[model samples]
Target: MNSSFPRLVEAVTLCFMSLNESCPRTVYTLALRGPLYLLFAVIVILIVIGNLLVICIIIFSQHLHTSTNFLVLSLSVAGLLLGVVVMPFSMVRSLETCWYFGKVFCNFHSTVDIILCNTTVWHLTFISIDRYLAVCHPMEYQKQMTNRLCVAMIMSSWSLSSVFGFTITLLDPEIKRKETFHMNCFGGCFALHTKEIGVQYSIIFYFIPVSIIVTVYSRIFFVAVRQSKLIHSYNYNPKAPLKSKGFKATKTLAVVIGTFLVCWTPFFMCNIIDPIIDHSVPPLLYEVFMWLAYLNTMFNPIIYSFFYRWFRETSKNFWERLLNILI
Candidate 1:
């Protein structure tokens, strides 16, 4: 599956390259320039700032270092790597409209991309399961979500993501080979195959994770609503001790899940549609959607800040200290 997938990607890449060369002077190419540059800048800045804030919040605030927070921190780290290591390459690819970085860099770039992408989804999956346990079975959550287990889960997530990503690197030799600059170099056979692989990836990396998140969060919402109703019924008293906190936390989780869905849905939808639709999508359109998926990394920290007070406060403190040093 690993080797075959890259071959497929390569084939698809060649097809697209052919189409791109043939249509270089088309309306699509002319329309892409300004927006693509703007998108590149915006996405890079957002991802850098957002992921940095996440890391700062996690690092400086000792109280925020719970097992759940650790998972979030790991996610932030992956996001940071994606922003720094992956986004620049994507920008370069967009500007050049070809893989000028040769085969080795291409392989490494793709490897990093896959690893980070998989890590993001897997982290979300792990978090959803954790939240489910916490909300549905509080006693068991307290027991099972120990520091040791948290570490193990994190390690497992990284290891599993790495294994899948590395498999792709090992399977595709052409991924590491520099191709001659033929007109067909942009999107030929290899490119078409890549497109198919992208569609399949939407199923593997996106649809499955989304399904898991939706199912888990749906159950969580139902449970929380039921519990809230029960609490309200039992206590005619105006002040219910846990009501506010529980409600706030549930709302925060909902926002987190919602942000993930919003950021990723368009990209995945494009992947699914591009394969079915025979007409070539504008390169700029693909670039826009690609950055949209990349925006997921940037939004996580912002969502955390908005929804979680501790993260917001910690971020403020960290920035204040940095400014103090600068001053």
Candidate 2:
């Protein structure tokens, strides 16, 4: 065995200092700490500000307020919480490899991670269902997706995710002790699941939601295509851009769903497979996939700003106001 392995592990306990008296005599060198912290800082800033902007746009733009936009706002809220609650600390842990935070915090943090990520997935599912109704059953969409219904869906998503997350943490000791010190290094946390738990989480939370999203979007696109054909066949040029805008919204959401599913698959696959292989996976690879999943949250608001008309208009107005204030 290479003698350097232990040092490498020890060195990972970088810049994060805690009051743990029994902490190993391992700290990341000055050279490594700077770049790592810089990287995390940029990521934290991006996710926070971008998602905040998304929330602001959805909330303040009255014209944008609808069942669909509210569902989007709910999803934005989850992404915001994930960024604010999970990302900064996770960045520290991923780099430091030491759980300087105490036992209680370890459990709380891991539970938050599980709950919020799962909630985001559920939010996406709700969004897909909403879009399906809007496009596939346009006449009934408004009645079916009332404000009360949207609120119920959001509440249900969070409630189910919380129950599932807390239950997993309670039943699975591995998750409860996710952040801790390794024998060779300090703060070695593994949120690795058992085979049964892994399978359940991957299938129930990730795979099922993804399938719903894909299926719903397929149906939505079919309706959109049919609508477009009808418009062309009749040469019916409507005065308002509402119908064309609706189709564009469907296209934009399709992009969103596609991007999310693409980013989500690898993480779920790893979650399912890693523990079944008794966690023989490389830490570097695991970290890569986890961060890649993190990027989904980061990308969502950016995607909306690029593709969603309301988001762009609201963001433009927001920036203009800020600039006026500065001036």
Candidate 3:
């Protein structure tokens, strides 16, 4: 009776184990435990919480809500969504061999992955333009980027990105969608862009945006460096303050743009090239590149904390206040 009772308890515990806990052994050399999963978990947490902290600081600190900083806040919000909505699904799809989230969710997840990522890119470009106006045309910067206009620009950015991403991707005919992206059998769920679809999206999302980012930042760097030289060479002057401040702001944004490019370029390259190469890239390699792109969302706040002095100060104060309330 004692032995039978122990066995009955063990059987009940096995039946109640999580779906994830019941994964069968595989021949794939995957580490779903220990260091690998831990690292992925950390990345997701930092991306979500770091972006959230940025949003909180921006919301609470009225001074930080300038036209340019508003653009930064928009990007951070996109990053927050990327981490909260996109990364967890990607992580599960990467770790597990099955797709239990249903077909409707598969479409929703794929669409959102594209939407949030596209929005982040637009915010980066607009932020660069804002910095440019501040550095190159201070008098006009105030006149041009009014608070109402900034709000309008933010709305336009989101609307344009969604319209572009969703419109282009969903325009593929019914048969094509089934052939490429559909998850049919409760098995692995990953968005596989067909060669035609890949080429179309790469041009729309990648090539054109890369051209804009490069062109804008190239001019920003030249103007910022030239102004920084003048500021350093002179004694205290009235114009010196504005020039120095604008140059510092440009520098901070330049780092942010550079980091975004570095983190996302690999995925962009692989994504475009994979279709051209008949999707010859190994699944694991593709997954690595994709996660590397997601890591940009994580790196955004780290870049801000490192380079942006106002953000650092505000963050410090925000944390202190929260700690005091908790204590």
Candidate 4:
């Protein structure tokens, strides 16, 4: 009994007490764990509520039913799914440093994570294109950006992301071997990518989309500047309205692109570098970068509230009506 007591005490710190190959848990002090749990829980709640509110606003507000707003709605859905279907599970795994849900679910979780994130990136890229057409080619904007085209863009983003995510996570035999090797312990779940895989993923999901966004936005800026100068030079400029719209586009570009870079660039940089460096990045630092990227979803609705007067007004009306109903 005395000899077995030592093993029992040691087992308390492992993910599975009965299994010799169980992963050890990162047991935090009570003081630290309390705050960490609270923080992640609050973030998950906010992400879900904010994305849902954005969807509601877009659905009920007639003025918000534009092609661009449809794309925004799709983006909100992706955020909502991430918050609902992904973040809670990740929160537990991240905090506990153990995977309770077994190997199959782990792959599913990882695949969904890749798909939703890529979906968000693709949506942002398409939105940038939409803005380019609206600001730089106002006369052709309505004619060129038809509802069919918008639907096509949305469909393509989702389908391509799904294919890529599934192929990498489930279908690739080499990646499967690497992932299994990484999850050597019974209670651990991790996906390990080779250096080549990491670089390919980063290029496809981050660099390509970001490059397109930057190039298109730069063109929009120059065109807007030219239009503003033309309007200022003429006393009676018919294109004054276009110049005003361009200013709005500039504001939108700054907030959207700036926030995206601040949130995601670190994570993607680490994603590529970690594999090249043989996963030298500390786990805590990697987790921090991952959560920071997740914050982009939470911030999307807040951005709308701040930058969109129409959204604010609609939100106000929504609250007032709900209060009246309750009263």
Off by over 4 Å in 2: 1-33, 175-186, 236-243, 322-327
Model 1 Cα shift for residue 90 (angstroms): 0.5
lDDT of 3 by residue, 205-286 (tens): 6677778878887887788778777866776565554456766776677788778888778877787787677667876688
C-alpha lDDT of residue 320 in model 1: 93
lDDT of 2 by residue, 271-293 (tens): 88877676666666777788888
- The residue ranges of model 3 lying beyond 4 angstroms of the native Cα positions read 1-33, 168-185, 236-243
Model 1 regions lying over 4 Å from their true place? 1-35, 173-196, 237-243, 276-282, 325-327
Steric collisions counted per model: 32, 6, 0, 0
Q: Over the stretch 1-327, how does candidate 4's per-residue lDDT look in tens digits? A: 356432211223878889887877767566666788999999999999999999988898888899999999999999999999999989888887788998888889888998998999999999999999999889999999999999999998899899888977765433333442435677776653557767888899899999999998889888888877776777576555545668677777779988998999999999888877767788778888999999999998999899888889999998888789999
List per-prediction Cα lDDT, in the order shown. 0.72, 0.77, 0.73, 0.84
lDDT of 3: 0.73
- Over 4 Å off in model 4, which ranges? 1-13, 172-182, 235-243
Best by TM-score: 4
lDDT of 2 at 153: 93
RMSD of each: 8.3, 4.9, 8.3, 5.8
- Pitting candidate 1 against candidate 3, the one with the higher lDDT is 3
